[model samples]
Target: MSQIPLLDLKAQFETMREEIYEAIRQVVESQYFVLGPVVRKFEESLEQYVGASHAVGCASGTDALILALAALDIGPGDEVVTTPFSFFSTASCAYKVGARPRFVDIDPGSFNMDPEKLAEAIGPRTRAILPVHLFGQCAAMQPILQTAAAHDIPVVEDAAQALGSTYEAPDGGGSGHAGTLGRLGCYSFFPSKNLGGFGDGGAVVTDDEQLAERLRSLRVHGGVQMYHHEDVGWNSRLDALQAAVLAVKLPRLDLWGQGRAENAKRYDALFAESGLVEAGAVRLPRRTGTGRHIFNQYTLRAKDRDRLRAHLNEAGVGHSVYYPVALHQQECFQELGYGEGSFPEAERACAEVLSLPVYPELTPAMLEQVVETIGRFY
Candidate 1:
């Protein structure tokens, strides 16, 4: 159906169609589609799920990052150290609030930021470390956190791709959720994420009550009451409609997460059976014991990356390159003084990594087609 999409939201929607309609119907009938009970309920559920003291809803994930940092007075004259391998929003959000993004290279093995280089990158101006849990895998957080602690800098987690994923659970190497390991965890409800909603929305979860209160105040013009400004905050509150939609989807997240885990295992087994490992033809994803890899995208690194993508497409097997360019090399950020080979690992990943269809709704037959297509390419 639909050419075996990289991800088929329609299949997911069908499973929850009736419940989604009812959730929205209730919100619509009440005519309270703005920040209301539904949003707060979802926030409360999310906070409990992650073992955080507070969760504050916002308009979108990018704003979630912006608000988390903004509330902490992270702006001009500050540097937020992060990885160059992730989505631009990880760095762009820092820039939005006037902070400079100091990028470090990634661990070629884990596809996560290297902790060794992180300590070296911190300078006197470093205010925070924004580590992204790329592709549902958490960064090596303990070391990153320790480094920040030594310098008394806060950490904001870009757990945008990692909602139900944990770093220490069965999937990850450790015991804490990826985002919870930081001072503040920012999540996105972008349409393509594991716990996606119908539209854009996000939230910030923190163990600090003061930070939580500040986030709530910040999302709505800094007003404790309407028209009464205190802190000059932006208007970024979450809508009740999106909240209801997310709530309806949240209950099924764990089950879907399990599907992804199983899918990853299946891929591993298939690749092993096909002798690709012995041939050194495919660099499969690394699943270090620290976090649950949610398999947001079943990415593989190989020599003939573009050729493989074309062959998969010819076989009607969907695939994509998450980011063909590293954030530091992007045209807009050229003034950051980065050029070719500036962050070689990240640059190499951009050229080599290819994302394949790994959504929960994908069938075993579809997976076979995907593996077969890749085998033919090899």
Candidate 2:
């Protein structure tokens, strides 16, 4: 038996190697490295794919968040309410723009911000409601949007891991793609993402034409023209090469997402049959809303998580913890005054969550091997 890696980018690349080579060659021949026709074409394609009126490409996912915040004029003395269990960039982006991040605990089932606790966290300084679509599952956006509307604050979605995922409104309204559901939706083209490019890339999508125009300017040092400056912004323009690669992959993103979902189903059934759930030894990821879960990483809560991780490592199985520490507990956030036990749910998640291989290219035999390894460990 060979090692079952957590993700297999090589397998994905082999399927479209020539297509990718051709795209890269086109960029090299044109010699247009910065934002130009190639980047614009990709951006337009992304806008149509994500169902957003506008999509602005940037340098990285973290920069996407910062640009969005800057476009909203959220600066010092303002606060952005967000979940504490997500990637560092989700909270750190607020700090980058000189705004404070107000932490909210996550729903243990979905690993997303609990909308029930959102109201209590919003203060007069609250400028934006930033919710992360963690592990490709949409946050409870209906309530989050309603709360934001009540306060006249904008909702910026961190859809870094959920490019094609959708969320159906609970009120029987309709479904919208993850990034397009909020006022400004941020996406990542990091190599590991579902719609990943060859290198770092990101974009911000919005229906607000004004914000979209501002985002375009913000990515190029706050100047739409060659030298005229309007506002202070970062140099965060997305590379033409990355955009070209991403454009090649965008059309197949939903198909890849489907494959990931199928893999997740297999894991769910295998874990259930192994009696781990019944014995309370492990808890599988849960699907909450009527939307699709792309399963960026199939994470589960396990008893004695560290030992289980070690066992998998010894067995030559790949596994990882999305986050090992809650944001509030990080040393850099000490002045925020969040002590231990402040967010019990997020802290518990940080301690027990472990992600397994759920990439699209995994074979059923490989999935079985992963489950067998876990079953033996238990």
Candidate 3:
């Protein structure tokens, strides 16, 4: 069998080649490169798709977080509470804005911030509550939101990996997309994301008109009008080309997510039949929430993860470790005074979690090969 890739953007591009080319042609003919009509139209479409009142396009997902924090005026001496299991930008964005990132441990099942631990992380200096929808599932937003609202603090969602994913309140209050559930939601269109664009691109979504306007100004160097600065901000505008490409792919996002979900189910069935779980060789990803899991990645908690990774490498099975280090344990964050046992669950996850190939383009044969390789490893 041919080698499987963790993600195959080339295969995805081939399926929509002409449509993508036409989108790019329109941008090229217009010669409008930066934020323009193309970007505005994409933002409008995204707002409707994500159920947000407004969406502001930005240069990257990291910028989306930084802009959201800056707009909220979360500067030095303020604290931003977030999960330590997420990508670096979740906490780094807070640091970039001159605020300290106070971490809350994750729920081992969902791999998201533990809502029960959220309130304790919030103190007098706390400015915002940032919860990440890690690996395409929404964080338990109901309790998180209730806690934030009680404190009058805003919730900024690091939804970079969870564009089409949703969350249903356990109380049956219905469901909402990952980004829209927060005061501000950030999405990444990096090539690996489910709804990725050609290059770096991201957006901030919100229901607040005032916050939306602030985000718009923040993306364009603190002014809607050229050269008119209301407040200092970054030049983080999303490119027109990337916006056009993303618009073309936006309509089919749900179908792609469905494909990924189907692949994940197959992997689950394969692993279950392999006796891996019964033998305690590995633990399958648990779907804790009642909402759609887009399966941006189908990760497992494997015993002897590093050795298994090397075996997969030798067998030519595509795999990866989502994060080998918790944010608090990173070299740069040493000054934060987080010790080895600060977040035991996150630290344990960093050691055991291994992501397998679950991209939309994978074939059944590829999936079987991945599982077979793991079975052989044990």
Better of 1 and 3 by lDDT: 3
Estimate, for each residue in 223-277, the C-alpha lDDT of model 2 and write its tens digit: 9997899988789999999998998999999999999999999999999999988
TM-score for each of the candidates: 0.96, 0.99, 0.99
The window of 10 residues in a row where model 2 has the poorest summed lDDT is 288-297
lDDT for position 146 in model 2: 91
Model 1 steric clash total: 13
2 versus 3: better lDDT goes to: 2
Worst 10 residues of 1 by lDDT: 168-177
lDDT of 1 by residue, 128-167 (tens): 8999988888888878887889999999999999988887
- The 0-to-1 C-alpha lDDT of every candidate, in the order given, reads 0.87, 0.94, 0.93
Best by lDDT: 2
Q: lDDT per residue, candidate 3, 250-339, as tens digits?
A: 999999999999999999999999999899999999997568999998988999999999988888788899899999999989999999
Which of candidates 1 and 2 reaches a greater TM-score? 2
